[model samples]
Target: MNTKIEKLEHILTAFYQEKQIPAHLSAATVYSLMAGGKRIRPLLFLELLEGFDVELTPTHYLVAASLEMIHTGSLIHDDLPAMDNDDYRRGKLTNHKQFDEATAILAGDSLFFDPFYVLSNADLPVEKLVKLIQELSFASGSFGMVAGQVLDMDGEGETLSLAQIEQIHRLKTGRLLTFPFVASGIIADKSEIDLEKLREAGEAVGLAFQIRDDILDVTASFEEIGKTPGKDILEEKSTYVALLGLDGAKNQLTEKLSVAKKLLTELGITDRSDIFKMIKQLEVK
Candidate 1:
C-alpha cells in the first residue's frame, strides 16, 4: 500500500511539472492535489485492479490520480463560503483561505476539468477510455455528486427521513465510491454480472464510510478530523447520527461492512485483504 501511495504521489508531482500550466494556477492546483487526504477512491481503484490480477502500470496510476483530482476538486468547492464555509481541511488552510475565493474556484475547476485531459492521454484503448470517461462523468456530474449536493443543501434545517438521507449519500458519496469498483471491473474486463456486484459492494462501503464520518463529526476534535467538526450539526443537516443515534449508527456501519465483505466474497476477488483492511480502518473508534 505504501508503495502504491508513493507511486501516486510521484505521478501527481510530475503532472504539473510536465504540463504547461501558469505559475499561480499551477501552485493552487498542486497545493490542493498535494493536500493530505486518505486517497480512498483512487486507492480502492488501484487495490481492486490488483485484486483482479491486473498488473499495475503508469496508466492505472494516471486513472487513479484522475479520480483523486475530482475528489479534491469537490472538496475545495465544498469548503467554499457558499457551501460548508470551512476554514481548514486536512489541517491546512482551505483553498479559499489559502488563496482567495476566485483562485480557489479556478483551482477546483482545474482539478475537475484537467482529469479528462489526463485520461485522454492515458495509454488505453479508445473504447475503454471512452467508457471510463462516460462512467466518470455520470458519477461526478449532475446525476451523481452534484445532484446529491443539491439535495443536501435543500434539506438543510429540515427534517429528513433515513431513506432520504441514504438517497442523498448513495448519489453524493456512494456514486464516487462505486466508481472505483465499476472502473476496476472495466479495466479488468470482468463480466457485467460481476460489475454489478462490485457496484453494490462499493455502495455499502460508501454508506459505512459516511456513517463513521457522522460519528466522528460528533466525537472528534479539530486535530482528529482535520476539518471543521460538527458542520452537519451546525448546518442542521441530516446524517446517520442525527437519525439513528450513536448506537444505531454504529450498528448500521457494522451491517454495511458485513454486506460489503459478503459481496466481495461473492465476487471471488483474489487479493481482497487490502480492501478489507481499508474497510476495517473506517471504524469510528
Candidate 2:
C-alpha cells in the first residue's frame, strides 16, 4: 500500500508541476496535496480495479489522482473558519492557517475543478469519460458530500437519532468513499448486480470507517490521530459514540465491518486478508 501510494503521489506531483500557474497558487495546491494521508480512497479504487482484472492504464492513475484532489480539497475547505474551524490536519497546519483564508479557498476551488480537467483530457472513450465525470460530480456535489456537510452543520449542537447520524455520514463521508468502488465497477464494466454489490460493500465500509473515526476522536490523542481530540464533544456534535455509547459504537463498527467483509465475499473477492487487516487496524484503541 505504501509503494502504491508513493507512486500515486509521484504521478500527482508531476501532473501539478506541469501546470502553468502562479507560483503561490501552485505552492498552496501542492502543500495540501502532498500532505501525508492514508490515500485510502484511491487505493481502494486501484485495488478493486486490479482485483477485477481491469487492464491498468494511465487514465486510471489520472482518476486516482482526481479522487485525491477532491478529497484533499474537501479537507482544506472543511478546516476553514467558516466550517469546522480546525487548526491542524494530518499533523500539519490547516490550509487556511498555513495560507491566507482567501488563498486556501481558491486552492480548494481549483482542486474541485482540476479533476474535471484531468478526466476531460484522459485517453478514454467519450462515453466512459462522460460517465466517470458525472459520477464524480454527483458524489462531490449538492446531492452528495455537500449535502452531508450541510446536514452536519444543521445537526451540530443538536441531539440526533442513529438514523439521522447515518444519513449525515452516508452523505458527508460515505459518498466519497463509495466513489472509488463505484468508479472501479464502471471502469471494469461490471454487471449491474456486481456494481450494486460493490456499492453495498463500499457503503458498509464507509460507515465503519466513520464510526472508527468517531471512536478515535474520543479515545486517541491529537498526536496519535493528527487532529484535535474531543472536538465532537466540544461542539456538541452527535456521533456514533454519543448515540450508541463507546461499547455500542464498537459493536456497530464490528457489525459494519462484518457486513462489508460479507459483501466482498459475495462479490467473489479472493484474498480478503488485506481488508480484514484494515478493519482490525481500526479497532478501538
Candidate 3:
C-alpha cells in the first residue's frame, strides 16, 4: 500500500512539473496538490485493480492521479469562507487562506477540469476512457459531492433525522469513495454483478469513513486530526455522533467496516490483507 501511494505521489509531482498553466494559478493549484494527504481514494482504486489481478501500467497511475485531483479540488472549495470557512487543512493554511479567495476558486476550478485532460490521455481504450470520465464527472459534480455539500450546508443548525444525514453523506462523501471501486471494475472488465458488489463495499467504506470522522471530531485534538476539532458541533451539523451518540456512532462505524470486509471475502479475494490494512486505518484511535 505504501508502495502504491508513493508511486501515485511521484506521478502527481511529475504531472504538475510537466503541465503549464498561468503563473499564480499554477502555483496555487500545486500548493494544495502537493499538500500532504492520505490519498485514500486513489490508493483504493489502485489497490482494487491489484486485487483483481490486473497488471497496472502508467495509464492506471494517470487515472489514480485524476481521482486525487478531483478530491483535492473538492477540499479547496469546501474550505472557502462561504463553505466550511476553514483556516487550516492538512495542518497548513487552506488554499483560500494560503493564497486568496479568488485565486483559490480558480485553483479549484483548474484542478476540477484538469482531471478530464489527464483521463483523456490515459492509454485505455476509448470506451473505458469514456466510462472513466463519465463516472468521475458524475461523482464530483452536482449529483454527487456538490449535492452533499449543498445538503450539508442547508442542514446546518437544523435537527436532521438519521436518514437525512445518511443521504447527505452518501452523496457528498460516498460517491467519490464508491468511484474507485467502480473504476477498478471498469478497468478490469469485471461482470456487472461483481461491479455491484464492489460498489456496495465502497459505499460501506465511505460511510465508515464519515462516521469515524464524526467520532474523531468530538474526541480528537488539533494535533490528532490535523484540523479544527469539534467543527461539527460548532456548526450544529447533524452527524452520526450527534444522533447516535459517540458509542452508537462507533458501533455503526464498526458495522459498516465489517460489512465492507465481508463483501471483499465474498468476492473471493485472497491475500486481501493490503486492502484490510487500509480499512483498519479508518478505525478510531
lDDT of 1 by residue, 1-285 (tens): 888888998877788776678888888888988888888999999888888888989999999999999999999999999998999999999999999999999989988998998888889998889989998899998999889989999999999999999999988888888889899999999899998999899899988888888999999999998988989998999899999999999999999999998988787777643877887888764
lDDT of each: 0.89, 0.86, 0.89
Alpha-carbon shift of residue 133 in model 3 (angstroms): 1.3
lDDT of 2 at 78: 95
Cα lDDT for residue 22, candidate 1: 82
| Model 1 spans with C-alpha error above 4 angstroms | none
- lDDT comparing candidate 2 with the true structure: 0.86
lDDT of candidate 3? 0.89
* TM-score for each predicted model, relative to the true structure: 0.97, 0.95, 0.97
Better of 2 and 3 by lDDT: 3
Clashes of each: 0, 0, 0
Q: Please give, for residues 1-285, the per-residue lDDT of candidate 3 as tens digits.
A: 778788888877667675555678878888998888899999888888888888889899999999999899999999999999999998999999999999999989988998899889999999999988999998898989999999999999999999999999999999999999899989989888998999999999989999999999999998877789999989999999999999999999999999999988787655743677899889874
Give, for candidate 1, the lowest lDDT window spanning 10 residues. Answer: 267-276
Find the 10 residues in a row with the least total lDDT in model 2: 270-279
